[model samples]
Target: MRKWLTGAVLGYFLYGLFVYWYIYMGGPDSIPEQFKGTSADPGTFMNSRELLLSGEYSRLRNFMYFITVPYEWFILLNVLLTGLSRKMEQWSDSIAKPDFLKTSIYLFWLSLIVTVCVLPVEWINYRISLSYQITTQSTTGWMKDQVIDFWVNFLLMALLVSVLFWLIRKYQKRWWLIAWTLSIPFSLFLMFIQPVVIDPLYNDFYPLENKELEEKILALADKADIPAEHVYEVNMSEKTNALNAYVTGIGSNSRIVLWDTTLNRLKEDEILFIMAHEMGHYVMKHIYVGIAGYLLLTLAGLYAIDKLSSAVIRNWGSILKIDSKKQIAALPLILILIGALTFASDPLTNTVSRYQEKSADMYAIQLTNNKEAAVSSFQELSKAGLSQVHPPFLIKLFRYSHPTILERILYLEEYHAEEQLKESQD
Candidate 1:
């Protein structure tokens, strides 16, 4: 057991070192040929290169990522050492009269323990964001959001965990399959209501007030046959300087959301290109495809977890005081295993996301047929977001959900070259 634990600890650090080395030490050669190069604009190129190694950038990146290893291990180690989960379960059983009340109290206290333990790290991350001028939210406002988020998570987890354990108790061996079947509707229910029900709790959103921009975005939607009516603008400048735009929801709920910062900082044409790209997401039905993919992965993960957790309980049930699969106290162990699985699968998931993003970029170029607009939009976004132009290869592999800024710009250049050749031939 000690040897197995030692090997797991060593393996985690070794994997992290490998990722860091591939990204920073391997340098440009680590990146694929098709994924290399910067924008043609000399000013953009110079600025990107400078910012990539800037002190503030380095501080922000390091501060954000450096805690991940220790923080993850801390959650698992603290839970195991202190036996917090088992204590919570025992306390809940003693005081609570009913199963529902017991489960709710147990989940609330457990989540609170986890949250309080991690609060310092969360605050430091927020402070770094503020120091870097990435976030505009006040400390008070941030605390408010944190409180709200905690309650939201606690409530959701209470419901879901209660249902999960109930299924486990009832079905035993087939619990995972039943749980997987149940998650599909709950997942869709959340998605369908999130934009309307949940989003308003965090930020104010309104229809894009600029009539001209709204008309233009709608016109692009029409061209793409996307059935979008009104573009939504989120009040994100109040909290962040990050530029972003996305399409979310389905059917009547479907809409494009532009960050206020995007509208304030970028040109009309650049915004148009962004809107077009979001429209591509809608037209391509990426959301549905993404949901389907997630369901499959979730099913597989649950099946594997069921098998692995049984093995774990068989080996260490007495030590951990977790004698049965139905016990809420086993959640910490389950979380640790899930975290390891997620970390291992990052590259595969990121690859799929990057591929979808590339397709959206191409669709935006084709829909708008304004290669210059597409190119300039990417350059502006990279500059405003302080995106790393040449991220380490391993970072691109495991962390990047979209193609790097350099890769996007290079692809636009290639697309423009092909368009120009076709024009000359015609």
Candidate 2:
């Protein structure tokens, strides 16, 4: 068992390494001096594999334009990668099952259905991710992510499948309930721990420097009617050369993380814009909303499990040891419930996230005291990332959190004009 596990792990590792090096060796002249200031360049790149490393904006534009066409170029790569990764994940799930045939059959049929109906839907979703402000995913790089993503998911999926299957065997009849009940605490633990625990596996993160910038940022916080004394930046370029910034946790643990790419690439104005955006999420208490949503959904899911698993209880209720109020072997039940909930909430979760991101966008523009800068900040982000400028609406509804890159730029442009008019009149 151990050797098999090791071999499986090694297979995934080698696959990922091959994919990464293939793309890396093929990538452009390294991002020349990010974050010292905005790029001397402006425009977009084409998405063909040939231009993956050119780093010219027109090429980027051509790329984004291609992606946007037929529902954006991003859909092809993202959806392909996601499918690949998910299958790799389910590979271990199949391995752990006593009825490997049943698991494989179910997964295959589902993937088939997903291919027919969900593929377009998924394509729309993934296409929308590229419809953001900033990115650098080339056709090849994007394809690489599809590969790396599968390997990552495979690791966790393996762990979950093994653990959950083990619990089901031990519990028997009321196994489903046991699984779900156990999953509640397990998920909760991940919610708090992930910001520290699992995240570091992919990238390096550490404290920020330049006490003066930190102090200035803190003072800016005071101006925004909030109090924050410190911030931390993480090295995101190490993993995949992506740019990102976010505020995670609450109270003492609540610290802002700026990706080195973002920190190194953005100007003071752009940095301020990004920080303000994160601050908007904080001020609006979106994290609280997310946690509250998850907790409520969990309880609802558990109630559902109790009702659904009654038959299992009736048949194998004795071995299960579940009663009106108490349960001894509840792990199996918990796993089933959580699993179902996770799948069910995919759309709802995206909807909520979209709202949160929109709010943050608006707040950042307002708090920064200039709509034009907000526009420019997003533009720089889009340029550096070589993002898709537009996305199909179908994808936006099911998958996206933020407004599309084109949508944001348009909004910022209109807002910029409106603000300028107001100032002129004043």
Candidate 3:
């Protein structure tokens, strides 16, 4: 066990070292001269000071990206191999009378333990955001959010784990299939409730206060044949300076939301473009597609876990103190496999997400026909978020769900030029 833990720590350290080198030492020396001063200046999007700040911010963010996954895996592995999971299982069993109660108690401990283990990393991330002026939330407010997040996660996970264990004991080998089938509706239920129920817990949400802008957005939605009645805005400025808008939920619960920061920072035309991009997602049915994709992935992952867990128990059951898949003590093993598989699948999932985003971008451009607003909206997004216009290949592969700001701007520019040239010919 010590050997396994040592190797994991060493491997993660080396990986972190490589990530540091790639971010700070190996990447291009500066933002390409083309992108340095285009938007406000004659030929670049950002000034020298902005460029320097963005570069530093991007490096730290990317470094966290590389380290977080392995750190999570290591934490789970340590819990499993050090007999902590078994101990927790025993404690839960002693304290609870009913099977469901026992399962919930065990899951609660597991969630709390993992959250405690990862708190420092979470703190570092929060501190980085604070230093970068990305977030203005006080530490007390942040910790409050963290506590809220923990309970929410614990509740959801406890329910899932209870059902999973029940399925495991009943069907054994077929548990994965049954669990996957159950998760379909379960996942949809979460999505349905998220906007109306879950989101309001974090921030105050209300109708967009600017009646004129709201009317314009509703008009745009009507033009697109969408049934949206009102645009919603969330009080995000109190938390972060980043600009964003998104579509959430489905059917009656479905709505488009704008962050107050987006409304404050962007011009009317720019805000419209952003809204159009989100509307594209709604019209395109990306949310339904995403749900389908998630269900399919969950199906495959649960199956893989079923086989892998059995094999691990057969091989290392004695050392790990996990005798069977039915044991709640196997939760760490299950989570470890899930974490590792999710990490392995990041590139493929990110690629699909990026494609969806690009399609939405094009849709927004065509619907709005405002190339300047579209381009400048992206530039402001980058500036507000300190986003890397050109991240490294690995970072882009694993982390980027949307195209870089530079890519979106260039695509808009090119498409507009093509349209103009065709009009001239006509």
Candidate 4:
């Protein structure tokens, strides 16, 4: 048992090491060939780091990122870990899936428990978040919000777990194929509903009063070739001190979202830079590409698990004190599955996301050329959030979807420098 456990754990560690190595080397060789020497303006530009140390900047960066970074990391890790352990069990010699109906019921109940537990823990974490002086919620307010949050998580979990498990059973050996088919629409569905249904749960969305800023964004989107339906603002400050903006939904749900805090907080040019970055994602079709990549990765994982079968399950199931052959493995199966998936695939995922961000940054820089906004936005984001200016490489690979602000600023400064060199020659 020790030998098997040692091998599995060691293998996992080695995989992590490989990911770090891959990302560390992400320095320059990873730059897409098409993007090489592509800047039309290569002007030397200064960074806003020192400026961010000023008073108001502090209010924005840390507080906002606290919730954003953790929330994204937490949910994503849960999903990946569940997938990994399930596949590991499938590869094991011991995996004995619960009977179809019973398996579905068991997995659903376990998911419900996991879903509900998140509320209290998250509320406690919210309290800890307040210790930072960036949060806006009082104890009573927090509890009320937690109640709303609980039901939101419950519904999302129920749907995701139930549908996913049933799909697994339906396809059985061919689960990968079915998953791919469903994931496409699921991505779109989340995109569509999130603006109205999911987002309002966290913060209130209000119509933007500034027709000028709204018009400005719409014009820039047109100039950038960013397809648009409409642009709007959410009253983000009503809930938290954090300032943020996002581009979510597709088709009818596809709308441009700017945080009311951001509009109130950042200057017009800075806001434009932020908007252009999101436009880059839309113009680049990142959503469809991400969905496709997710399908492929998920299918590959299930296929990997099918090859191994049961031995993986018995080994860890025993170690974890989970029932070896009974339906209890269903939950452990789900948990470990998520953990292992994260352990295996996180590196590749982070790399791809980083690349997309770089591309987005390029587009933003091109449209605005307001290097001041780029730098100011960073300071604003950093000060508001209290973000770790620099993170351990492992954390970045495992957790962050967007490039670290420092890395992003560095990229902007580098591109800005190259543009200056070319212009001097002209």
Candidate 4: where are CA atoms >4 Å away? 1-121, 163-171, 305-309, 314-329
Per-residue lDDT value at 157 in model 3: 85
Per-residue CA lDDT of model 2 for 300-348, tens digit only, reads 7755665666665566444334432222123234444455566567668
Please state the error at residue 120 of candidate 2 in Å. Answer: 22
List candidate 2 segments past 4 Å from native: 1-189, 302-344, 421-426
lDDT order of candidates, top first = 3, 1, 4, 2
Give the alpha carbon lDDT tens digit for every residue of 28-107 in model 4. 22223443333311111223543333222322332333333333334423432445434433443244344444444444
Specify the poorest-scoring 10-residue window by lDDT in model 4: 38-47
The segments of candidate 3 whose C-alpha lies over 4 angstroms from its true place after superposition are 29-43
Better of 1 and 3 by lDDT: 3
Regions of model 1 farther than 4 Å from truth? 1-59
Candidate 4 Cα RMSD (Å): 8.6
TM-score of each: 0.91, 0.55, 0.96, 0.71
Alpha carbon lDDT of residue 268, candidate 4? 91
lDDT of 4: 0.63
Q: 3 or 4, which is superior by lDDT? A: 3
- Backbone atom clashes (below 3 Å) for every candidate: 1, 48, 6, 48
